[model samples]
Target: MTSMRTLPQSSPTDETPLVALRNLRVGMPAPDGGAPVIVLDGVDLTIAKGEIVGLVGESGSGKSMMALSMIGLVPPPVRVLSGSIKLEGRELIGLPERQWRSTRGGTVGMVFQDPMTGLNPVRSVGALLTESVRRHQRVDNRRALEIAEKALLAVGVPAARERLSAYPHQLSGGLRQRVMIALALVNDPKVIIADEPTTALDATIQAQILDLLRDRLHAAGGLMITHDLGVAADICDRIAVIYHGRIVEEGPTADVLRRPRHPYTAGLLAAVPHFGSRGSRLEPIPGQPPGPTRERAACSFQPRCKHARQACALAPALVASGPERRVACHNPIEEAAR
Candidate 1:
């Protein structure tokens, strides 16, 4: 298990975060079940108003579980042990299910990666959209349809009024993805949690979806979960690099991307195929992250990090490095930009 000294508390920012979590921990059933596996360990993050913060990591890094935890959607056998999850100063950690339902579609919304699984196969798109608005707004059928139409039109869904009558199967992949986004926006939520939204779409459609979320929707704040460093750079104002249930590094997107202090973040950026570096082979991170049940008091990435040292035996807490920058590493890289 990892152990770290508590970080110093900073002066409160001028604006409070729209969504905030401090010392949050979550547990799930382990593969070789003797005890519950720790999925997230003392994770802290915040999304400020009117900004997009991307959570980037490789698959199976608990990024998606963290997303689910934010909105209180963590399923059975996966439960929060302790800590605070606050939205706009309201405590969400122990809120009852009834209260959470109101907060879900009304204040916070989720857009899953795959539209097919998210949408019902038997229902018409209109029925789905109409029901979403009615569930949260409690409006009549006619009013609900009107809200859905406006939401679809606002997201640039072509023939918004006509497409409402079509079912999920009838639409193209791109249009279906747009429909899912429209579904998330039907209630005009303040915080949108999009989990790997671009993974299933083509490059052209992915650009469109990102633009819609960045420019149109998410005026308050947003949490975008993505594996692509390039996508994080494109839309995220700030980026958090998560690995093995902890944040390795976080800062303004430019700062983290240009001068990654943590080796994991640097490795992720290195794997990306830069436009100017076409001739070189794509560099991938050498090893896998520790499993859910596995925990290390020392650096878990010691095996993979080329920069590891004897001092790395001690666990490192996420410490402030520069303006709006934090890294959890003993041997942080010093790049020219810094």
Candidate 2:
């Protein structure tokens, strides 16, 4: 087994990782009389102050689930059975809904994947933004409106003053996303959870949105949930590759992309288009992700792993092997393999 890297732990007073989760397990009731489904199992993650951590994996890999769990937003049927979610060292797991309501959008903001779902179609962008500011701060309508306009302009929305009156349906997709970001940042949250913020947008617009988010949140530090390895490499200071509810490989973005230790991580990187690539076909990881109904007693990737062995039956924990790298594979890919 290769040794993993050990990075410096942020100081307790840093106020970074305004939000964090450790050993989180989200479960759902089973249809029949059996154990509840485990959507997330033993997940440990951290987002430091002024740092961006990308959670990358295929769909249903529990990336979004992890984000939702942090803010107490897991949808119906799925419940957080056990875990420790802390925001600035304050526990958030068992907090009541009222407390969560007070904390969410106030201290910790979130940006969803779809603007239409996140924004209110009936409400004008200005009203939504102003409401968010008013909800958290003890400000009157005039001050809230001023803060809203400033936030909209801060997000690069042109003529923010006039655009504030426009409803979400009247704006372009890119503009709507900008509004979503404006709303998320209006309260000056210490942390932001952006789940697939670039989904469904064209490459050009996607790049623009990503750039805006990266630049705007550069100092606040947050967690970005995404499936695009390219985006992860571009924006995240570090990347963690999740597979079947557990992180398989995690390290500095440059290190992970250049030398993926886990097979799944390698496959994801290989799938990204490279400049001047010659006849290199994108390789997809064969086999479907394990369904919620499936039992997870052993390694989740064993069935699709090329190096699986009898030892895979015993699940491997994420172990450090470098200054800033960790992998859970019994047989990790070496740097020379790629």
Candidate 3:
């Protein structure tokens, strides 16, 4: 299998990435007007035009926050303290709401975790999808409906035209998810952010959804935010592991999954089930992650890391661990162990 590097050097002719995130820091203001509660800290990532990069992390590790920030929908109270989110060379961090409205579905699209909640229960699927198309493109009602139907067909939804007339409640879970994908793709966006798109589906349906995404995402960059390393391994070219709102490790998918450098990543891999390790018990990470109220200037995983030492009192910068890999750890898992 070939490995795809996420760094700039990997580009064919140093082409600019479709989406670039650098030194991103997002936080919520404290009630006392003191320090802010950080959600995403000094994160750097890039997505090119062709591959899908997976952001893997625990529930509160700020996966969704990163996604929302890119689309300029971080919501009130939680704000981007400092960061750069560039889509196709244009800065998106401080863009006005008016511009963001066009960019959200036109340039970058998002497929949320729950399709049921994502879609309007009262509105027909056609109404929801056509509205997105009409808003982004200067198209009439007939053209918008045609575009909506095409989007559904692109995502493998059967009876695409007829399905559009059905309400969200009328469709099955898989159908609803397919419709959600259609809505995201209807505007022909350059980048797509799929937040656990298969979490609620059965094994068969999940496989089908993944296949559809794989087929359609070849021409567009994708950021797949998932907690399951298994799912990331299946579709992502590279995997970035986030811990405590910071990216602890990032590398080609095969390399990270087979020989994780960060201890937290290793712990996560151990907890997942494998066919060969069927008889063995899974080892969960030892300590609970710090809540939003707790602020840590040092390494957030130190409390649970067995390799932690006095040097870990300060958070390590994400630096090169090996070829095509970076890890934020003073004591990374030795290569010889692999």
Candidate 4:
């Protein structure tokens, strides 16, 4: 993985984040009717205005669950047990469905992973985009259609108006992705949560979509959920590493990628196939992640971490490892060691 681009600078105004999650704990009912299964445990994260933060981890690491919780879409049975989610100083935890609906696309928008499945197959592009606009903004049908066309144009879709009549199946994969982005941006929401937005596209298309997002997200803060650290390094100003529902490490992109403190973060960075290191074998992290039902009495990563110590038997709090960086590890890799 070659360096994609110079990392974007963190905002000075980040003192007040656009989205703040503090001690967030989400859980689902246990299979045996015992205790609930924890999906997100005491997660703390913040995304300031005009910055894109990456929420990254392996599958079932609660990345998507966090995103859903923000948009008030966390499915039933899986509940937000305790936590505070503030959007620009407004509380969103117990908002009613009506308020959540208004907040969904008005204040926060989401770009799901699969454009094919995310878009409504029966609806035309015009109808889909216009409906979103009308639902959020007080706009007539004609104005909504105009907004939809303008959004398409903004996303670099050719013949924006003509494309409005086309169905989701009529467009190419790249075009569908563009439409997905356009829909997310149509309302000009303050916070955008893009969950693996480029996963379904090819490399070239993925790069294009990423570029589009970077350009369009300048006004609003973003949370990009992905497993691809390369993509995160390319576009995110900061990166947060979550494991078994806990944020184990977080820092600026360059800092985290160059000199990771947590062993899991280091393992993830090492697993990427670097362009400069040709013929070198990838070093995948050893062992599977703990089951969701497993309790978090001790360090959840102690089983797979080579640097684990007896102290790891007790869970380490996410303490400051460096300026603007936090790592939850009893024996973090020293900066001089790398």
Candidate 5:
């Protein structure tokens, strides 16, 4: 793990950030004495109050790891070498486990990608929901149950009262996800981190879940992690494009989507399927992302970038490219086609 270091921040707001992660580096052990396989490298992000920031990237781009770090749930063996996670301007890097446990579901609630993984199979949904609220809020069983029912109803869980005794496997995938969202909201946390909340569901269920999160779930701000840019564009106020553990492009959703500066961003957008486009073939990005253990000196995407040049031999730092756009490329793409 690298040492925690501070970096220059580029935030849209001058006011304090609700959640700020600066110079965060995370990695796993290498075969020998070589550098650790860097999973996250000097990532800086800010989520202001009332803002919904989307963290979009491929499978191994460190999206979920960043979310776990926020909730102090970063899995072991993958250590956070150095960086600062601040909540309301308070540093959380060095917080004791005792304090982190208190902060987990209380200050920051997480809605994982799959409820099947996050939920207990043996326990009834009612028990799972009530347990979450009870952990953060001091309430008796009856009141905890009441909060659970309200939370379920708020998330569109049908027959909320009757569903309490049902096991997670008994409900459909959509219903189970609704319960997860409900559990996350029951605590009324100040911030929410949703890691691919709509991943495994069908199209209809996905839309319904997104609608619920966007319209009903209220909090200080949110960090939504997903591989789908369309989903990000649909719900996020801003989007941060991560490639090889680094944010290659970030800006307002409209700006990034309308005028993507990074070739990687353009590549991702080109892969999306537009509505009413019958018989249209979806363009997929060529080549797979480098493995986690693969080391690189220059641009990680250089091998795949059509516009890569000799200058890219020296890696580029994320720099301001437009009024609200930042891109980390020696030769970034021009504004995206309208």
Candidate 6:
């Protein structure tokens, strides 16, 4: 079994990864008597302390599943079958639900993709924020309310005191998202998992929310799951490109964006528009992601890769190619000689 191994004793620095997922595999039982359905396959990722790690991929690429697994929020029909999720020297995977519940919001907070689904429509924003504060801190309603309002203000919501009394629907999409962020940060978690936090807002609003999150959460690290490479480039220190539930490449955001090493990663970057690009005609990756039910052996992306060779028939493990980059491909992209 692939195991999560830490580098022999290293001090905490801007360089050391704060959270690490090693050889992670999340799978579920197949409905028609077949091999287990693999949603996340032998994935490995690292996020430095106080750094932003962006996980990017097309739809159904298991970006959200990976995020949910980190915080023990994987819904039914999916389970973490193996691997270790280490956060600040503690293993999170395989921990009992009770233990995870105790540590989740306090140690690791999460801001889901859709604020509407995450927030309680029946309750006012104030009630929801207060509840989050009360759950983690030993404080009365008065103190919790104070903390809740402070959280709102921290996320840039004006008149936080008044906004707390309003229902989720009363706020704009951007405001509701800010409230979501406030709830995530109420307990001052060490790591925050934001899954497409800006999906529902306008481009300008999205930029604002991303900026706020990047600024306010600079002290604590973050893992942002997004399909937009532009967003990732704007906010993340490093980028991990996931294709068909597996990470094909990972490196500094600038490195990966400028010189993608995996075919899948290259295809994704090519599909994005550039400043000098001709028209708005976007070039999407051809073919759909493999079905979750399919049993995968060889490289899952071999069928779609333009550079697939005989060696690709055997799955490639993520291998270190440089001090800060890794690629899982038999035919890796050649780095330009300086």
Best by TM-score: 3
**Residues 22-48, candidate 2, lDDT per residue (tens digit)?**
888888977795888888888888878
Lowest summed lDDT across 10 adjacent residues in model 5 is found at 1-10
- Give me the runs in candidate 3 sitting further than 4 Å from their true place: 1-14
Residue lDDT tens for model 4, 1-338: 13311323242234456888989999897779887889999999998899899999999999999999999899988999899998876779999999999998888989999998989999999999999999998989999999999999999999999999999999999999999999998999999999999999999999999999887776688999999998999899999999999999999999999999999999998899999888999999999988686477889999999999999999999999879999999999997877
Model 3, residue 158: what's the lDDT?
A: 89
What TM-score do all the candidates reach, one by one?
0.92, 0.93, 0.94, 0.94, 0.91, 0.92
Please report the candidate that would top lDDT against the real structure: 4
Best-first order by TM-score: 3, 4, 2, 6, 1, 5
Candidate RMSDs in order: 4.6, 4.2, 4.5, 6.6, 4.1, 3.1
Q: Tens digits of per-residue lDDT for model 5 on 1-338?
A: 13222333333235668888999988886659678988888899988888899999999888988888787777888878899898877778888998998788888888888866777999998998888888888999999999999989989998999999999999999999999888878888779889999998889999999988886433458988999988998999999999999999999998898888888988898888888997888877889998775465788889899889999987799888878778999988864433
In angstroms, how far off is 60's CA in candidate 1? 0.8
Off by over 4 Å in 2: 1-12, 15-17, 31-33
Residue 69 in candidate 2, Cα distance off native in Å: 1.0
TM-score of structure candidate 3: 0.94
Better of 2 and 6 by TM-score: 2
Least accurate 10 contiguous residues by lDDT in model 4: 1-10
Please provide the root mean square deviation of candidate 2 (C-alpha atoms, Å). 4.2
lDDT of each: 0.85, 0.86, 0.89, 0.90, 0.86, 0.86
Model 5 stretches with alpha carbons more than 4 Å out: 1-14, 31-33, 216-218, 277-281, 336-338
How good is model 2 by TM-score? 0.93
> Candidate 6 clashing pairs?
none
Model 5 / residue 119 / CA error / Å: 2.0
Q: In candidate 4, which residue ranges exceed 4 Å CA deviation?
A: 1-15, 30-34
